[model samples]
Target: MKLGILGGTFNPVHTAHLRIAEEVRERCGLDRILFVPAATPPHKELAGAIPFADRYAMVAAAIADNPDFVATDLENRRAGKSYSVHTLELLHEEYPQDTFYFIIGMDSYRSLGIWKDFPRLFELANLVVAARPGIPCKDPLALLPVVIRDQFCYHESAHMLRHRSGNIVVFFEETYLDISSTQIRRLVSEGRSIRYLLPTAVEHYIYRHGLYHNDERF
Candidate 1:
């Protein structure tokens, strides 16, 4: 089985998040995509960040209609800070026969070196670096160590990822989404409507919970 992992804070899952997963599934020929919400993101930890359960619940609601998209609380359920390498290791052990693909943005790809146990992560799963608008694939050498830079596979779109490596390769998704959870949070905090920015269910959930309002970080 081919499984794609789309890990994020998902403080509130949006249409773009669902769209990216769908595109990746179709483009990468993935049997299913898992949305893993981070419990404690190492890089971006904000004060008054929404609780993990609320974020998980919102994600579950956003992707419930898509059979190919599923939600996982691995980070939330696990102890300690959430790290990609640890999650990938656990996933590989649990599904030895399955091939795992780690989906991430081009910007995130540029910062892979600073990630914890990044080298081990590459060995466990193929890294699918999704391109972003205005962000060119700069020198991987400058961004990452020589050993770590060797693990990347670039793809122009989700379509290209589907036909990769005779079923053994890291896929690159070229198409980029303009949406961001951080932007959504800012809009909400500014008393602006995010109707089109996110899934209807997610927007409703945010409003119902009154999140981002009291969140000073926003």
Candidate 2:
């Protein structure tokens, strides 16, 4: 089975998160998507993030009705900063039979070299990068390390790179909402309406718990 993994600091899971997962699942024929909420993401500062429990609950509530969506606590249960390489390694170990595809935005893919175990991550799971229309990534292939670059060959017919080991890099064009967690946090702090910006349950959960009412540096 092809499993899609989307990891992030879902301070409060929103509609956009669900949409992206659904889009990728349908576009790539994925069996299901597991939302892994980062307990402590190494790349982002966690100064203003809500409690891990709260974040986890919100993700669960947001995806409650979607049979294809699953909320996982893999990173949350682990100790220390949540690194993608470590997460992928553990996932590969536990689900040896499943083909893993990690969904990431183009912005994060640009900094792949900085990730833990950098190039080796390419071997653990296929990467599916979400790209907005009208803007192509600036020489993404050239940006990859020489060794990793050699692992894949672009197949013009599929518009994707087929890796030697069957781990591919699929460049998927998707319609992503402009909404962001950062923006949502800011809006809540300023008493602005977040209606339609997030799942109704998540929006209510944020307000009920005063998740980002004060909005300290996210």
lDDT of candidates 1 onward, in order: 0.76, 0.86
lDDT of 1 by residue, 1-218 (tens): 99999999887788778877888788878999989999998888744668998999999989878888888888877898899999988888778899998888767866777999866765677667667556555443445566744444434453232222333333344556677777888888888888888778888888888888766575
- Candidate whose lDDT is highest: 2
1-218 per-residue lDDT for model 2 (tens digits): 89999999987678888888999999989999989999988987865757889999999999998899998889977898899989998898878999999999988888788888887777889999998888776556765767678877877667677777878888877886888888888889899999999999999998899888888675
In terms of lDDT, model 1 sits at: 0.76
What TM-score fits each model? 0.85, 0.94
Worst ten in a row by lDDT for model 2: 136-145
Q: How many backbone clashes does candidate 1 have?
A: 3
Clashes of each: 3, 0
Residue 144 in model 2: shift from native, Å?
Answer: 1.5
Residue 75 shift from truth in candidate 1, angstroms: 1.0
